[model samples]
Target: MSILVYAEHDNKNLKTETNKTVTAALKIGGDVHVLVAGTNCQSVAEQAAKITGVNKVLVADNAAYEHQLAENVSALVLEIAADYDTIMATALTTGKNFMPRVAALLDVAQISDIIDVESADTFVRPIYAGNAIATVKSLDTKKVLTVRATAFDAAGSDNSAEIVTLSNVTDAGISSHVKDELTVSARPDLGAASIVISGGRGMQNGDNFKLLDGIADKLGAAIGASRAAVDAGFVPNDMQVGQTGKIVAPDLYIAVGISGAIQHLAGMKDSKVIVAINKDPEAPIFQVADYGLEADLFDALPELEAKL
Candidate 1:
């Protein structure tokens, strides 16, 4: 039995999450094969081959897969599903979008957002916004899963494997192309950041976000916002840190002006070291924080910046 992993890339550059997915796949007890589907992604395929446990890399270079459209990717992955006992991908936007389609096409349920490998067939995953862990056993002939990269350590490039080009181009001719709306930021992306500094409604206004600049710069942290701040238009939705937005596990998370709602805590409680600075001594964030500072953030920001 072999396991197939889908390698995610932007056609030109490989995403770091692929390594984490490969690492998780290695624990599933099988020979691992990584599939790189794109128009011209040989370099990306070769990069996947460099991951330690991958046995072979399949490069499906096709015009239809140029954009990694869910329909095309699902068709291509489903075409090869019969050859493998398990199919896995990173539980990112790309995988979440396509993996369910593959499962539906195969008439097998997908084990979404797997956090632990119980066996070759069974897995552990989170349900109800990570409040509890569910141990799931897949009964299908082929087990399909999407792994949460943040839950596992990433695979290293300790060895090289064979790179095989897959020339089979199965085209699903369904195109609903639309204009892309892109938001670029100099600050690190929240999902990939090692440290995050988030603010709540206590920051008061959009102008108060500047208070975090010095501290974030010193710590190399991404700026994040609580739901209240986002709802107030103090920051964009992309910066939101809560149960509904991105789940982040960083080395250090500094919460300023945040009272810490249960929804917000659910998203960041897993962070290694939580530090909270709030004016209210009775704020809920203080309950979980490793270090709690009950003071005005306006006064604390400069002091924290000076110390950092």
Candidate 2:
């Protein structure tokens, strides 16, 4: 069986998630090929060709694919869908947006956020806000999968695969490029950080997040927030970590003043080590924390920052 992985890049650099997704594809036992779709993204294609298990790299350099609009990318994937048995992408914003369109167009089941591959057809995915693991067998001849990158090790760069350019392009004029309001931060990307420090409603206000800034800078950690913090306007929605937000598996996760709602646990439960700091000893976060400290954050933050 041949597998096609959708390369995730920013035209210049390949995202680590793509390498992790490739690892998932390799585990499915196939000749792995990566599809790099973007305008002026030849650099990304070249980088993908070096991934350890990739057999070939397909490049579709066109303006329509530059922004990776779901309408256009889905159509492009469908054009070559017959060449591969499985099509996979990282379970990120981009993949979550377009993979369903491809599945719907092909009239097949789209397995979402698969954490494990039991076989070529049977996969293990989280369900019910990650409260359960569901093993599903897809009856469709063609499998379209969105892999959770945090579950797999990234594929190393060890080989030089042949690169093939494609002329087939799709442009759905229904959408157009618009302005992007991005939060520019010097800190590490939240999903890829080795250490993450997060706050919750207990933070009270946005200015108080500075308490984490000193600690984050000391450890070179990324800052995250619970859905409560976001809802309470203590931080932007992008900084939220929960079932409805970003998924992370950092080596060390620190929860500050979080009550440990199940939705919040679903996002960072995979962290190698978890530390919870809350005034209430009975907070559910202590249940999953490797280290639990009962203290007032106002007092603890300064002490921790000084100690670090």
Candidate 3:
């Protein structure tokens, strides 16, 4: 079955999640095309064309789609839904915003956050905050899905493919872009980083969080915080890692001074190599940890920094 993937991007660069979604699309087994919808996004289209498994990149360059407003994006995707048997995107904020709308417009049930593609018709996904996995088989003629990116390896941009420009794009005129306020950080993006070092309520105060910075720098890891740390004003909400926040599966996840709560485990339990450092031996984080260190973080932090 042919597939169309929504290529999410800013004006400058394609988000890393798109590559992983493309990898998932390849498993569906057919000619895969990516739809790049944004203003002055020829660069984005060109980048998508080079993804290894993609056969074509469809470009819909228009002012109405600049910010990926759900109404217009849903309309644009619906206009071309008839040709493809499956349509999928990364299960990020952008995909979560519009995939349901597209599915509704096409009059089909949307399969959300699929982690594995057992077949073109059967898929595996998480249910109940990832407490359980469900393997669902959709009978819909036109299958629509949003893939959990962390489950798939990212597609590389080493191939050359054709780029086609879409015409007569429809504008729903229901939404408009106002302004964007972005948080700028020099550390690796938490979602994309290979290694992440996170703190929690055990960190005590905001200034105490400085204990993690040095270790993070030495490891070149992104700094994350539990809901407690963010709620306690130790960091911004964007830094929070839990069920209600971003779900990440890094290669190496180091939880310092964080008692692993169920909500927090829902986010990082999938990490490849989990290291938990807490004085309390019975913290739930230790149950799933690959390497558990029972020590005060204040002392452990310095030791790790010295060794790394």
Candidate 4:
């Protein structure tokens, strides 16, 4: 089987999730070809060509793909969809936006957020807020899937693959690129951080998030927030981590003043070492935490910061 994995990028550097998705594609047993679709993204294609298991790098460089709008990118993918047995991308905001349209256009089932590839046709995915695992077998001739990056190790960069530039481009004028308002942070990205420290509604207010700042700086960790904290206006939505938010599987996840709701757990439950600090003993977060600390965050924060 041959697989076409979408390479996620920002025109300059390749996203870490692309490497992880490539690893998943390799696991499915195929000649992995990465599709780098963006304007002035030759550098991104070069980076993808270095991935360990990639067989080829396909570049679709055009202004229509600059912002990677779902309408344009999906149309581009469909133009060459007939050659690949399986098409997949990381379960990121961009992938989620376009892959469904590709599936609908192809008239096939789109498997979402697959954590494991039992086979080329069968897969394992999380369901019901990650409370259950569903094993599904697709009967479609062309398989469309979204891989959960955290579940697999990233593919290394050691080999140079053949780079093929495609001239067949699609410009869907239905949607146009608008300005992007991004959150600039000095800390590591939440999804790729080795260690993460998150706050929740228990933080009381946005100013209290400073308590985690010292700890995050000391450990060089990324800061995240539960949906509650974002909803309460303690932080921006970008900092939120949960079922409806970004999924992270850091080596160490410290949850301060956060009650573990199922939605929140679905995001970070896969962390290697989970530490939960909450005054309430029955907060569901403690159930999944490898280390549970029952204490007032007001007192705990200061002491922990000093100790760090």
Candidate 5:
């Protein structure tokens, strides 16, 4: 039996999340081969070969495969699906966009955001916005899974495997294009950050968000927001952390003035250390907090900022 992992990358460089997916795939105890499907991504294929537990690297390089358009990618991955018993990818935008199509082509349900491996074919995953855990056993001959990076430790880059360049067999025609305009930030992404500090509706306005900025800078933490704060226009939708937003599992999570709703907890409950600061002792956020401070956020901000 062998496992196939999809390597996520830009045309030039591989994303770190690929290692996390590979780590999860390694737990299944099989030869791991990563498939890199894109134009001019031979370097990324080589990079994937350097990751530990990868037995071989497959590159489907073609000019038409640029941009990893879901149509082109799904077609390429499906062509090689019969060769492996299990296929996996990171649960990023790219994987979420294309893996479902591959699963459909194979007539099997895709196990999304898997957190644990029960056995070779059985797995544990989250559902209902992480409020429930589902244990699934795949009876199909082939299995396709997407791993939640935050739920698993990434693989180390210590292995030296051979790179095997594969021919691009699929017609890489895209009906639509997705272009990216990246906003560069010194702060890390919330989902992958080790520390996170999120604000809520108590901050009142966007201007007050700056109060958390200095503390975040001191703590070297990614900034996050509650759904209520995002809806109040205090922050952008990307900063939201809740059932409707991103899931995070940071080493430390500090929530200021955020009344923890079950939805909000669903996103951050996996964090190792949770700290909640709110004036109301009855706030639900205190239930999951490792440290709780009941005080006005406005008065506490400067003190917390000074201490940090």
Candidate 6:
């Protein structure tokens, strides 16, 4: 059976999430082709063609797919859906938004945030806000999936796959691109960062968040905040990490003064190493932590900064 992967990329380059999704596709073991749908995205397609296990690359250079409009992108996938047994994409905002529509149009169930491919049809995914792991089996002829990139290793770039231009295309003209107002930061993107240092209500105020700046700079870590910190207006909503916010699976996660609420754990419980620093010895975060430091963050932050 053949698999078609939706290549997630900016017009200039392929996103790292796509590399990880390609790793997931490789695990299923098949003729894997990547589809790059965008406007003047040949550079992105060329990069996708270099992924180790890709059998081929399909490029649909179109103005209609510039913004990845769900209607247009879903329609584009549906046009080529018949050529492959499974269609997959990274479980990021773009994938989550459009894959469901593709599934509905194909009359198939879409398995989301799949962490493991148990078999060709059975998959493992987090459910109930990541409190439970569910094994799902799809009996549909065509399987649609959004892969959790953090659960898989990125595919290497050691192949020279053939590139094919797709002439058969579809556009619904249902939406148009508006100006994008994105928050640009010098630090690593939260989802892609290897190490994340997050603050919580313990910060008490916005100015206190500056405490994490030194630690973050020392380790080249991204700064994240608990929902409490964001709710209290200590940080921008974009910096929040929780079930309600962005899911993160970093190599190391340091929680400062953050009470480990279930809501908070849902987003970061999957981190490889967890360190919780709170004066409360019994905070729920400590239960899941690899290292727990029970002390006032005010005292600990300075010492930790000095030691690091």
* Top-lDDT candidate index: 4
Measured against the true structure, the TM-scores of the candidates, in listed sequence, are 0.93, 0.98, 0.96, 0.98, 0.93, 0.95
lDDT of 3: 0.91
Residue pairs in steric clash, candidate 1?
A: none
Better model by lDDT, 4 or 6?
4
Which segments of model 5 are wrong by more than 4 Å?
A: 169-174
lDDT (10s digit) by residue, model 2, range 78-170: 999999999999998889999999999989999999999999999999999899999999999999999999999999998899999999989
Q: What local distance difference test score does each model get? A: 0.88, 0.95, 0.91, 0.96, 0.89, 0.92
Model 5 agreement with the true structure over 146-185: per-residue lDDT tens digits: 9988888889888789988887667655465667667567
Residue-level lDDT of model 6, residues 57-136, one tens digit each, is 99999888888999999998999899999999999889999999999999999999999998889999999888999999
User: Model 1: runs farther than 4 Å from truth?
Assistant: none
Kindly list the per-residue Cα lDDT of model 1 for residues 226-246, writing each as its tens digit.
999999999888788877776
* Root-mean-square deviation of every model: 1.8, 0.9, 1.4, 0.8, 1.8, 1.5
Model 6 bad stretches (over 4 Å): none
Candidate 4 residue lDDT tens string, 1-308: 89999998999999989999998898889899999999999999999999999999999999999999999999999999998999999999999999999999999999999999999999999999899999999999999999999999999999899999999788978999779999999999999999999999999999999999999999999999999999999999999999999999999999998999999999999999999999999999999999999999999998999998
Evaluate model 5: give its TM-score.
Answer: 0.93
**lDDT winner between candidates 3 and 5:** 3
Residue 152 Cα positional deviation in candidate 3, in Å, after optimal superposition: 0.5
* Reference-based TM-score, model 3: 0.96
What does the lDDT read for residue 294 in candidate 5? 96
Look at candidate 5 and tell me the lDDT of residue 209: 90
Off by over 4 Å in 4: none
